[model samples]
Target chain A: MLKINDLHASVEDKAILRGINLHVKPGEVHAIMGPNGSGKSTLASVVAGKEEYEVQSGEILLDGENIDELSAEERAHKGVFLSFQYPVEIPGVSVTNFMKTAINETRKAQGLKEMPANEMLKMIRQKSELLEIDRKFLSRSLNEGFSGGEKKRNEIFQMAMLEPKLAILDETDSGLDIDALRIVANGVNKLKSEDNAVIVITHYQRLLDYIVPDFVHVLYEGRIVKSGTKELAHELEAKGYDWIKEEVGV
Target chain B: MSKYTEDDLREELKTKEYEYGFYTDIESETFPVGLNEDIVRAISKKKEEPEWMTEWRLEAFRSWQEMIEPEWANVHYEKPDFQAISYYSAPNSKPKYDSLDEVDPELLATFEKLGISLDEQKKLAGVAMDVVVDSVSVATTFKKTLAEKGIIFCSISEAIQEHPELVKKYIGTVVPQKDNFYAALNSAVFSDGSFCYIPKGVRCPMELSTYFRINQAGTGQFERTLVIADEGSYVSYLEGCTAPSRDENQLHAAVVELIALDDAEIKYSTVQNWFPGDADGKGGVFNFVTKRGLCEKNAKISWTQVETGSAVTWKYPSCVLKGDNSVGEFYSIAVTNNYQQADTGTKMVHLGNNTKSTIISKGISAGKSQNSYRGLVQVSSRAENARNFSQCDSLLMGNLCGAHTFPYIEANNKTAKIEHEATTSKIGEDQIFYCNQRGIDTEKAIALIVNGFSKEVLNKLPMEFAVEAQKLLEISLEGSVG
Candidate 1:
């Protein structure tokens, strides 16, 4: 569903992703694990077409179309989604209104009319139910004063609303407790299907136990240095990333 | 992708044109350019005012001659040449229109172009409109409906002729002749504005609105609005203005006064959209207005204004709580873009015991404009237990713009409780990216962010006016970001 060839990206003359490559097919769950500052979030942001990060010498493709020239919003219209590591706080916009605007705008970009108000409400209710979000929480300002777990869950709620084909959960498990992690992982697992894909990026292996990935890749420095199955997560959790660093002689 | 820097946003903001820049070709009988005692007398004579009114104008003119233009505002502008502007200009035909068909077609077209057709306003919005062109009120709608409820609504000139007792008792009672430099000038040579009076124990059936337009090129617009809510009465008044694009700065110095008698309530709102000149700041309106209200015992007064135009603006709508347990409120959203400068806020004076006041100000500055909020809260020694809360927030769109706050508080009463809070924030790139990633464009994202920032103040507006104000904010900031 998504392809990245020789992905070299930087921000303000500082290279972050150097010659990284990744490919993910539909219906497959891919886990990209790494220590701090290993370009995990940068890869997600680049795929989402963040303007600050310049694609120095690489290309990203979604559904066999070169999306390097598309804007972040255009990419979103074409079914690309990125769950931000830290959600922004918009003080006066309710989560429902924000979702409505996002959904309507994406529909508008595709030459469709705005979603019917009743249908939008129904979808919101269904998604919030799927994610176990409070009804009152949808009316509060977007992410303003939200707890860390609530923010992460809200990001997942948005992913469910957009129903993007390629969803990149960048550090979604960072601030979640055990219960919250189970709920978030359960929500992601239910939304999985054959026509879409999920890429989970995390620093720890605790989340893999809930939303068990089919493939695990360890990203060190700027590139993925090792690839294995679900058992590799338990292996790394028992040991540590130091063994991988030694194996890569870094 | 190409880099969309702040410089690019600044360039885009500069390219936006003022939408209401079209001039109407109407023949007008314009007074010669100059201001003196004789000119003030001539204006009073043109209105055929009573002898006392003429003497009042002369007194104001005398005070104005002695008063120099104040320069204390946080604004920089080439001082307007007062003598170079025509003091009065009215359309040639002065016949009173009995109905819409009797009005001038060209004049109706002007209102239509302004998106305020009198016929539509009367039929649809149920709003009584006093349409003022140049310095003369051309049409006053829904007068009979308002008069049915003992609500006196008409032009100031009509009110002076027909209801002199009410006009004489309240005119200049709140903002006197020597209130300030602009107030003195406006009091001296003001031509026309709306005057509304809600009778005792009566509520106005509909919104009282006045739409001021400056069509003549060189004439200065000086309008004086007076609203009086008698004992146990209630009223809501709205005022809006716009001017044609010109190469020289035109002057718009207006004075508004409100009186809320014992147990009465008054709500006054202004959506000022005067011409804001071109991108280079060549010409626009010099808006220096004085608006103040007086609240009697147990009375309440509220002022809500959304200001988005003018090259240079200096306005402060204030309330004086004179009676015990009275309330005052001020809610404002001021937007400036592309060389526009606005210094606007409100003043709350707690002279009565146990009185309260609240102020919410939102200023949005884009392009190279400068926006400032200057407010004052004063609690007198006799005002025991007076309380006031104020919040001033500013949002800047680009690096070249500026926002400033000047808050003054004076509490003499030991029991007074006053609190003030302020914040200044820029539209962060992360916020924009978040919206963009959700499929919203840059322009739509800016509109969303700004409307969010201004939701508090916008909520205070009347439902219809709130929608228009929101649209105005979006239009004012169009192309302000990539």
Candidate 2:
């Protein structure tokens, strides 16, 4: 469902993703584990089409179509979603209004009519209940004055609302408590299907316990140095990233 | 003095007409373009004012001649050649309008172009309008309905004729003729604007509005509006203005004075969309207006404005808190695009003890235009326990535009608590990308963010005008963002 070939990206002339090659098929969960400066978040941002990252040379394909030249909004219309590490706080913009605009915009781009307000509200209610988010939370400004855990949960709530084809969770468990993390993982796990995929980018393997991945890739210096099964997450969690660094010889 | 014997030398001359040289052929009576003692006398004589009123006009004219144009605003334009412009241009039509059916079609057509149908304006449930076409008030709707509640709504000229005592007493009390240059100019040669008086203990049943349109070329619009809310009375007044597109800069110097007596409340709102100059800045309206309100003991006054158009706008709607426990507020969203320049804000003067004031200003600048918010908050020594809060925010659409904020706070009373906050920021690419990533396009994203930036001020607008203001903001910022 997704492919990245020799993805070389930089910001302000400083290369962040030197050479990255990865692929994921449908119905599979892939976890990328790395240290703080291993370009894990940069990889997610590049895939989401952030303008600040300069793609010196690369090709990103989603469902066999080149997406590197597409705009962020166009990519979003193609069912690409990014769960931000720090959600932006848009003041005075109600969550329901923001979500409706986003949902309708995506649907319109996909050649569908706008959803009725009542139906949208009903859908939001059902999703809120499923995600355990309070109904009043949808009326408040998006992420304004929300707690750290609430922000992460809101990110997951948005993911559920958009129902993107490829969901990239960038450190979604960083600020979440264990229970919040479990709830977030549960929400992601519920949305998984045979035609969609999930890429969980994290520094800790604790989140891997809730949403187990089919494959684990150890990223070191912007390159995927090793790949294995779910046991690789446990091995890294026990011995830390030093083992990978020693094995890769810098 | 020409050539030889039967030859004569003739020099052909052309008048430097208005840069906005559009003319509508409506039969009108106009005073010649010049200013002197006789012109003031003629204006007073034409209105058939009392002796004291004539003396007042003369005093204002003399004071105006002595004072020079103010250079304090952040606008740059040649001083208007006041002596070379006509101050009064009234339609030559008769003043006998027994009913709405007797109104002139030409005047009605002008209103039609302004999108104001007289019938629709009359049928609007809670709105009363006084239409000022050119230099005179043509018709005032809902006068009888308003009069039943002891609320007096009429033209300033009619008020001078019917309610002369009230007009003579409080006409210039709030905004004295010598208050400023434009005020003095308006005082010297002011034409007709609306006059609204809410009686004591009466809450006005409807929103009082006045529409001022300038249709004649080479004519300066000097409208003087006075709204007084008596003790315990409440009123909301709205003013909207527009002008035909012109290349010669048309001069518009208006003075609006609002007075709120003890325990009274007054809310004044304006949606000004005067013709901004062409994209090349060839011509537009030069709006130098003076609007001020005075709040007596326990009275409150609020000024809300959505300014979208004007070539060079220089105005500050202010308030004077003279009564104890009085409150003043100003909420504004001033946008300038395509060579439009505006230097506008508000001032609050706390003169009585325990007075309070709040100011929120949002300025959006685009397309090499310059927008500024200049305000002042002053607390006199007698105003103990005075409080004030001011927030001014500016959003720049491009690198070429400019946004500036200048706030001056003067506190002679040690007990006064005043706080001022301002921020200037350009719409960053990251913020835009975030919105775009959500499937919202660039234009809608810009509108959403701009709306959010001005939400604080927009919330203060009246319900009907809020939607209009939002649409205006969106249209004004078109082609602003890349």
Candidate 3:
């Protein structure tokens, strides 16, 4: 469902992703693990079409179509979603209003009429219950005063609302407590389907316990140095990334 | 970003004239471009003012001549060459028609071009309008119906002749003729504007509105409006203005005064969209206005404005809390894009004990525009237990634009309590990307963010005007997104 060939991206002349090659088929979950500054988050940002990053040479294809020229919004309409590392606080805009606008905008791009208010409210309530989010959170300003755990959970809740074809979770477990982490992972696990793909980018293997991945890739210095199965996550969690850096002579 | 020299910056500031600039070829009765005792008397005579009104105008004119233009506002513009501009320029043809159908087609066309629906069939229900073209009130609607409720609504000129005693008692009472430079100039040669008076113990039956359009070139429009709410009465007055896009900057100096007596309430709202100069900031309207209201004891007055146009706007619609337990409120959202510049806010003067006031100002600056909020809150010695709360926020779209806040607070009574909070922020790229990732384009994202910034102020407007103001904010910020 997604392919990245020799993805070389840089921001402000500083290369962050150097020749990254990856692919994921439908219904599969892939996890990318790396230490801080190892380009794990950069990889997710590059895939989401952030304009600040310069893709010097490479092409990204989604569903066999070149999408490098598409805007972030166009990519979203094409069912590509990114769970932000740090959710933005948009004051005075209620969460429900924001979600409704996003949902209607995506539907409009797909040439579909807006969902009825009652139906939309019902879906939101169901999703909130699944994500363990209180109904009052839906009426407050978008993440205005939410804690770190609340923010991460809200990101997962938004992911559920958007229902993108390819969901890229960037460090979704970084600030979550044990229970919040389980709930977020459970939400992502429940969203899995045969025609969709999920890529979990994290530094810790603890999250892998909840939403197990079919494949794990170890990234270092902007390159994917090793690829293996779910056991690879446990190996790295025990040995840590420094052993790999020493083995790779970096 | 490319480094530009001084010449490049100068070129960047060159502005173009936008769409509203088609001038009509109608003849007009204009006074010479100067002011004197005779000119003031002539204007009064032209309107057939009552003897007492003529004397009152003369007194204001003399006081205005003695006052100096205030230099306190955070605005920079060449002092207007008042002696070189025509102040009273009315259309030559007078409407002799006994009904709205007989109003001149040319004048009606002007209003239509300004996007104001004047046709009887298109008029909104429960909305009465007074149309002011150039410097004269051409036609007033729902006059008979309004009169049936003892509500007197007409042009200032007509009020002077019809209700001279009322006009004489209230003119310049709230905002004196010598209040400021522009106010003094307006007082010296003010032409005509709307005059509304809700009788004692009566609530106005409809929304009273006045539309002011500047149609002639090189003519400076000085309009004076006065609205009075008698004891226990209630009224809502709305003012909407538009001017033809002009390459040469046109001067508009208007003064509006409002008075709410004991147990009365007044709500005044304005949607000011004068011609903002082109992208380069070459030609537009220079709007210098003074608007103020007085709330007597137990009375309330509120001012709500959405100012999105004008090349340079310098106006402060203030309120004077003179009666105990009276309330004053100001809600404004001012947007300046391109080369437009605006320095506007309100003043709250508390003279009676237990008075209260609230001010909320939101400014959005994009492109190379400059927006500032300058406000003052003064509590008198006798205003014990008075309270005021002020919040001013600015949103900058890019680094090129500027946003500033200048708040002046003075408390003389030990029991007075005042609180102020202000914040300035740029629309970060991450926020834009977050919205874009939700299938919202950059333009729509910018609009959404701006609307959110102005939600507090916009929500204060009347229902219909709030929607109109929201649409205006969207259109005004076109191409402002990165």
Best candidate (score: lDDT): 1
**Per-residue lDDT value at A174 in model 1:** 89
Proportion of native contacts kept per candidate = 0.80, 0.48, 0.62
Which runs of model 3 end up more than 4 angstroms from their true locations? A113-119, B1-21, B24-27, B96-100, B120-125, B480-482
Q: Write the per-residue lDDT of candidate 2 for residues A1-250, one digit (tens) a residue.
A: 8999999999889999988999999999999998989999999989998877888898899999999888788899999999888888776688887888899989998999999989998889888999889998888887889988888888888888998899999999998899989999998898899989999999899999999999999888989999999999999999999989999998
**lDDT score, candidate 1, position B61:** 90
Candidate 3 residue lDDT tens string, B414-464: 999999999998777788789988888776776788888899998888777
State the DockQ of every prediction: 0.83, 0.24, 0.51
lDDT digits (tens) for residues B388-481 of candidate 1: 9999999998998999999999999999999999999998889989999999988898899999999998898888789888988888887754
- Clashing residue pairs in candidate 2 are B18-B248, B19-B247, B19-B248, B20-B246, B20-B247, B20-B248
Model 2 chain A: worst 10 consecutive residues (lDDT sum): A88-97
Candidate 3 docking classification: medium
What are the per-residue Cα lDDT tens digits for candidate 2 across B1-482? 01111000001001111232245678888899999989988987887767777788889999998999989888888777888898778888758476778888877777776667878878865678888889888887788989899999998878888899999999999999898888988987887788899999999988888888888888999999999999999998988877788778889999999999999999999998887877677788899999999999999999999998788999899999999999999999998876789999999999999999999999988776889999999999999999999999998876667998989899999999999998887766666667777888666776887888888988988787788789777766754322
Candidate 2 segments whose C-alpha is farther than 4 A from its true place? A12-19, A56-58, A111-113, A242-250, B1-30, B44-54, B91-118, B480-482
i-RMSD per candidate, Å: 0.9, 18.4, 5.0
What CAPRI class is candidate 2?
acceptable
lDDT by residue for model 3 over A1-250, one digit each (tens)?
9999999989889998899999999999999999899898888877888777778898899999988888788899999999988999888888888899899989998999998999999999989998878999888888889988888888888899999999999999998899989989999998899989999999899999999999999999999988999999999999998888997898
Among residues 3 or more apart in sequence or in different chains, the pairs in candidate 1 whose N, CA or C atoms overlap within 3 Å are none
Model 2 TM-score relative to the real fold: 0.90
Local error of candidate 1 at B239, Å? 1.6
